[model samples]
Target: MKFSQWIGFTILAFCVYILWNIRQLLLLLFTAAIIANFLNHGVQLLQRIGMKRGSAVLSSILLSLIVLSGFFLIIIPPFAEQLPELFKLVSLGLDQLILTIKDFILRLDPELIKALPNSQQVVEQLEPLIQIIAGQGLSVFYTTLGIPLTLLLLFALTLMLLVNPSAYRQGFIRLFPSFYRKKIDHILTECDRSLQGKLTRILFKMVMITMLSFIGLSLLGMRLTLAQSMLAGILTFIPNIGPVLSLIPPVAIALLENPWKSLSVFVLYIIFYLVISIIESKFVAPLLIENRKSILPAVTLLAQVFFGISFGVLGFFLALPLALVAQVWLKEVLVKDILDQWKSNYNYSHQEFTSELKKK
Candidate 1:
């Protein structure tokens, strides 16, 4: 490579290195941007209804806080009360399971007992996990929910963005070449609209899942139906693995009640997951995005896995939206404009459009 090309490559590598180092912070900022984008819609609506910009922003923030406060009120208390019980029940369930195993083992031939899983050894392996849950389940649960300081920092950044989004937007657009700034701005707008549709669809899915889970749990006579159903709903915001996480609490409680019923609970949740997936893919999604081409399941799963590995939990939470942003830019800029426009650059007879025109 030429000396100048080498220099440019080194600078690009350094930039990527810096970005990698700050990836977590970038994810956090992106999260804040998403929140701000949604809030901005409310601010825009209020402004259209004759409120001043300042009043609209303030009202939007206040309204957001109210909704958040209500969400916490609904979630926190139920989880606080049920979590410990859930943990205790899970512990008892394990013990009961071990007892059943032991009894079966005692009835079996001594050689066969040795061949099968030893109840005592199984308990020894699971002992630490059971102890941790019994000892610090609530702390773990709350920590997973999030730390207050981190959440505060997140919202503060969101407010900053929400206050004057257009300024940040234009500043970002200015970073592109003058000739391409318009195109960049248009791409950003597309991303924003795509993101809004995704967020709305996600919210719709959450509500539907919550309702469906609640009724399913009730029909199955599951313990702590409300808390488990609510958990199912909230976790629906996450992509692939959320359903698995939501399955744990009910299954644990079911195990405590009856080992066989735990199997039933497991099967029931699998059904609910499938039902919700079908409902969203068939009904909710199309209404949310007009002419929305179906995204590949493998691609969505790949995004979840890639983001979860790269960005940890935050990436998993934002995976779909992040993927949405990438998809919009790639589709509009690369596939539609660059690739399609560049087709004329080739004089190959194998080109279908050119060949068809010649045939005509």
Candidate 2:
């Protein structure tokens, strides 16, 4: 309407355009922030036990490094060695499965036998899509192309943020007006808490899934059970979809080991999934997170699409947590404060004017 208003709009649009252009860097920063937050909790814990801040931070970093080292060392080497055999077993399993299906169809109806899709053709069609999805997911953590550099930067940024979080927190608060600084600080705290709770929930699922899968797979006499279970646990980070994918390799191996055992392995996974889901829903979630505002499956899928598009593979992996953080901020700052207050403020003003008129 006014020149100042037009100028303000232009500036705001320009800022958004700038932000869009640098989104990748922003995402990397966000990833760093999430890592920092996770580490910060460890730092806080150490501090509570009389450790100094610097030592706590360094200890947290080293502890993370140790954990990661253990994962790669213990998990990767065995998986790498078994990979070829695993693939062969999987192929055999698929072939056997197809044959079994064909035989079943032939018994039920001769016509249905001719209609059965060729497994080779289906695999060929799916191969490229699977490669792309897997590649992208892998890129989130490491790509041979960017391996050390990207990860180095990520860790470096995380350490910097973790080292002096209050400075960054205050810097962010200072962006707002003096009067609103306190409110912004409060909102940031809420986001921190929300993110921490989400991280805790995911970690719980990972540990439980890993332990259960190991025990169940071992009982089934599967090869490489520990590595497979570890993979399953890590895959739990991907939410509903990941655990399902994790089942494929083991199920195929089970089938190759013993066709009958395939069914047993499958049943075990289902039972464990049900058990884990119930515990999370009934106890872990409630204890960790105050607001159990469910993340709908549809919304989760949409988050994958949006983040995957915006940030690529890395975005896809971080989508759930990013969505969670965004949800908290939007609810607290936008919906609760801005949108919800509008009508109430309007009603209050109207009532005040009415009172003045009656007094007059």
Candidate 3:
């Protein structure tokens, strides 16, 4: 390789090393960027209505605050009321289930019934694990409380970006070689368009699914339908595992009400989710994405699990978008340039071989 090419490769390698080392910071910044983009869209809409940019940004921020407050107001009370009751019911039902299992065991083999551990003793043995699980749950709740702070920082950064997006654009453009800057800019624009389109459509679909789930569960007389449905919809972004998580609350409640009812509710939930997911995977997502490429759903979900484990709840929420960004970078920069070069080299050697064969 030429001296300049070697130097460029070294610099790129160094940058990659730095990025790997500071991935947490990068994640936070990426999340901020997404929030900024959403805020910018809202501000732009207000601007189209003849509002001044400053006024538009301020109004957008205020509107966001109102929406968030309203969401919390709607969600919290029902959750608080249902959680304790749900836990009590779960404990009682578990005890009853154990008794039923023991009775069946006695009927099948009298000796096996004597071998079974007392239910209370088993529960005592499991207490530490249960406490650990509850601790993790509380940590999630604490992380959620940080959302307001995150939003504040995001809004402040967004206002600055909205006020002068060109400054950041120019800075980013300057990071590339002069020959590639314009191409990079165009790629960035395409990415923004793709991300924005997909995000909006996906959010809308999730909301629709949530509402439908709520209505169905309510009609079925399930407890905490609203909260459960809302949670299910929100977690839908997590792909394969999301619907399963959503099913737990309703199924647990049903089990508490009656084992047979729980089995029926489980079947109904499975059917409902199957139909919804099929429509989403086959039609909705494809239409929204249109001919645009995206990361594999499996890769996206795996990334979510990895990030959620490492960084907790914030990571979970940001995982899919981060995966999407990584996919775009890999496709545009790595595959297009590096892999295409390798392909060209292969083609050249093949053509030379064919020419030599003809001469032979």
Best by TM-score: 2
- TM-score of every candidate relative to the true structure: 0.74, 0.82, 0.71
Q: lDDT for model 2, please.
A: 0.82
Candidate 1 weakest ten by summed lDDT = 132-141
Q: After superposition, how far is residue 41 of candidate 2 from its true place, in Å?
A: 0.9
Output the worst ten-in-a-row residue range by lDDT, candidate 2. 136-145
lDDT of each: 0.79, 0.82, 0.72
Clashing pairs in 3: none
Please rank every candidate by TM-score, starting with the best.
2, 1, 3
Q: Cα miss at 239, model 3 (Å)?
A: 1.9
The number of the candidate with the highest lDDT is 2
Q: Model 3 RMSD to the real structure? A: 6.4
Candidate 2, 1-360: lDDT as tens digits: 999999999999999999987676788899999999888988999999999999999899899999999978887887788777767777787777778788889889989877766977888997775666566556545633276787788888998999999999899899888989888888787777778887788889899989999899888789878767877888889866788888887887887768789889988998998899899879887677444565788888788777776677778788888888788778888999898887657788999999999999
Provide backbone clash counts, one per model. Answer: 0, 0, 0
TM-score, cand. 1 vs. native: 0.74
When 1 and 3 are scored with lDDT, the better candidate is 1
